[model samples]
Target: MSRRTAVIALTALAPVSWGSTYAVTTEFLPPDRPLFTGLMRALPAGLALLAITRTLPRGAWWWKSAALGALNIGAFFPLLFLAAYRLPGGVAAVVGSVGPLFVVALAALLLRERPTARALLAAIAAAFGVSLVVLKAGAALDLVGVLAGLASAVSMSAGTVLTKRWGRPEGVGPLVLTGWQLSAGGLLIAPVALLVEGAPPALDGRAIAGYAYLALANTAVAYWLWFRGIERLTATSVTLLGPLSPISAAVIGWAALGQALGPVQLAGMAIAFGATLAGQLPSRGTFSPAERNGQELSVDPRIPAVRR
Candidate 1:
């Protein structure tokens, strides 16, 4: 495969793995400990990456890494877990599906990329399709859960745009950047999890295996791919792939979790998947106006500064 296609496929794996989180949490992990689960998913994986990379942030990056971590991991995780616990079925997924719209607007404002009509429409269609796939006819929504879902979406959206805007420091690979954010975010979650949830719950073999999968596959590696993709692709394209999470969730629910998928859900999946594919199409040229004019745009990090 071409490099761009490979990046897209690898990045797409992040959300696809994330789609299994609900099932893993419900089936194997302890109950009513969203903070702890978030902690487990982030901290160990982060520390592992840090050890492997053996790189530390310098100067401004220390703060930048911390900020990005808070938005993407610390804040996003607990909120996401809260929504999953409180909101039944697809309500949380539907709420979170608005992320692309948030990214589109943020990119326009923060990244100075013009929003394309296709992106706007795809975001709407993806949300609607996800709602159909996951939202039950009368799934009662908790007010707190809805708010949490919205907040998580916003937090992650902001994190994504900021990641794209900042890019990585010279000589810092996505592995190092991923480690920094995960560690920072995990540390942030540690105190709150301790305060709110008290002690960590004892883990059985099932829970241990679940947490291990979450930390390694779902979080550490997945986030590395995600950040890597962000370095190459437009923020809009990256976030648009988020719909796959719910669609994957639904499929897993059917095949693994014994949840049924009716005709409507199938149609919804098709629509959402279609929008996801469409979102990957290039928006104008990848280069910004300044770059096209043979001028450097602000910071030129080690990563190729492609906006699309």
Candidate 2:
């Protein structure tokens, strides 16, 4: 595969692994401890990465890492859990699907990446398709849940855009950057998890295994790939891949959990997948440093330009 294609594939794995979280949580984890679950997913993974990398954020990155941690992990986890608890799963999934739209708008303002009409349409179609895949008719919406879901999407979107805007410090790879954010985010979540959930639940072998998988394969490695992709790809392109999370969830539900997929769900999957591919195609506004500052410079001629 070409370099861009390869990067995209690796990045896609993050969400695909994330899609398995629901099944794992329901089957193996302790009941009704979303905060603790989120904590386990984040803290151990972060600390492990920090131990492995042994690189700490310096100067401005100390706070930068903290800010990113809050947006991407700390705030994101609680808001996401709140929405999932309060809203129907379908409603929550549909709200989260709007993340691409949020990323598109933020990329325009923050990263100076222009938003295309095609990008907007693809975002809308992705949300519609995810709704079809996950949404149930007559599902009720809780306003707080809806707002929390929206906020979570915005938080992650902003995080993605900022990551793209402030490329990692020279000589600092994504692993170190990932370590910083995860540790910061995990630290932020610690007290909240304690306050809300009271204490960590005791874990049996199954739950321990589940948390291990989530911390390692799901959060640490997946986020490493995600941040690495943000370094290489446009923020909009990265966020557009999010539809795969729900689609993967639906597929796993069918295959592993014995949930049925009807014609409408199948159709929705096709549409969403098509939109994801469309989002990857070269468009008018690829990432350009000049676009941000109205400078006359262009991206390096040596680096192959990623299409919008």
Candidate topping TM-score: 2
Backbone collisions counted per model: 0, 0
Over the stretch 1-308, how does candidate 2's per-residue lDDT look in tens digits? 65568778999999888999999899889999998888899889999998998889999999999999999999999999999999999999999999999999998897778899989999999999999999999999999999999999999999998888777776677899999998899999999999988977788999999999999998999999999878777888889899999999999999999999999999999999999988888665553564343332222233344332
**All candidates: TM-score:** 0.92, 0.93
Task: Name the Cα RMSD for model 2.
Answer: 4.5
**C-alpha positional error of residue 256 in candidate 2 after TM-score superposition, expressed in Å:** 0.7
Stretches > 4 Å off in candidate 2 = 284-308
> At residue 77, what lDDT does model 2 achieve?
94
CA lDDT of each prediction against the hidden true structure: 0.89, 0.88
TM-score of 1: 0.92
Query: Can you write out model 1's per-residue Cα lDDT over 197-262, one digit (the tens) per residue?
Result: 999999999999999999999999999999988877789999999999988988899999899999
- Note each model's CA RMSD in angstroms: 3.5, 4.5
